[model samples]
Target: MADNDFVPLTPREGAALGDDVYAVLGEAILRGTLRPGDRLRDVELAARLGVSRTPVREALQRLERLGLVEVAANRYTRVTEAHPDAYAHTTEFMTYIAGDAAILGLARATSEQHTDLIEAVDALIARSERNDGMGILGGTTAFYQLLIRATGNHVFITIMREAGLALQRNLQGWTQPDEDVELRTTRYRRLRDAVVARDGRAAESILMEPEPSALALRGRPSLG
Candidate 1:
């Protein structure tokens, strides 16, 4: 999907439809329906959503803020391609949130959360050991997601939480898949073990940089 779809949902008339718009339209964009540099028609988008232009406009505004849209006064709105600046900005923002959560997660995560995290890590390791694609990778991804939640930061957790589909798309684009999932699975263990040890720095480091060797199995590069 186009990066436009990552717009966070905003409440509208007491109903949160932004995610629906962002998710559906974003999926279309990712699947190449609404591609980068494609002009967006507000009225057309509203009609598609069966809503007024306000929500469409709001969604576009959020997308613009996210660096996924470019809007000109009374002229046009369009999806924008990924740029280094955008990536650096967004990744920095995400990393900040993640770092805070890592610190807090190490301190505040409950014993149950730690146990759940360990189990998830074990699952990931098993997948890496098996070294399979589309199956173990899928499972390992789920486990990584659970680790994010164990951090106990609700907002960042929510943001990363909704990123499941998006992450799948990104992984498919940037990561390599192989017959053996076990090596990749061990990365999860590394992160979890750090968390289990209450070493926030170690956990965050594992997150900031994963095992390149295992990632190479997927044969994809980093995404913007």
Candidate 2:
């Protein structure tokens, strides 16, 4: 795609400016608005976002570190193509980390935090009903993020931040078509109930259940 063809991002009102830019650009990439091999020009993005080139550059660098974008000095900066094995690897990592977080979170979470988790699960069901791919992605991320926060493990949080981005991108690529809204809601409801009951083992089991997409990734001949 041409440089001018990239979708423009609106300047966000709150939070750190760089973080907002990173989120907007990252979501665009995850949504496939910025496809693989599409070049990212900081000057154009800066102009489009009504920000200085600094944050755009910073965001681009952050994306590169996440393996979402490739930057070759003086040559180009482009969105990276999906790796065929990424889905399996990411799901494996998320299963363990998120499962552990669920156990710890159940142990650590306060009454308010339990309520927040239930609310997050409700939001996930709502997004699934609407078949909103991005919403589903964000809601799932938020649910796990809350759990990770409750664990108070900064190291795991950092790891999730890095791995979660790739997982979201891969999920966005494959999840929508086969997403069963009823099944998803049922699964999340079970998870929420477990967390609310402080049933750590049950919560872990629910979270670790093999996702359809992960199973497909293992069996499919090709991602294409």
Candidate number of the best lDDT: 2
lDDT of 1: 0.60
For all candidates, the clash counts are 26, 0
| Residues 156-215 of candidate 1: C-alpha lDDT, one tens digit per residue | 687775654434444434344333344455666776678679788886676566344332
User: Where is the poorest 10-residue window by lDDT in model 1?
Assistant: 210-219
Model 2 over residues 26-66: C-alpha lDDT tens digits? 88888778889988888888877778899989889889988
Q: Candidate 1: lDDT of 95? A: 46
Which runs of model 2 end up more than 4 angstroms from their true locations?
Answer: 1-14, 118-142, 158-164, 175-193, 209-222
User: What global local distance difference test value does model 2 have?
Assistant: 0.74
Each model's lDDT comes to: 0.60, 0.74
Model 1 scores a TM of 0.68
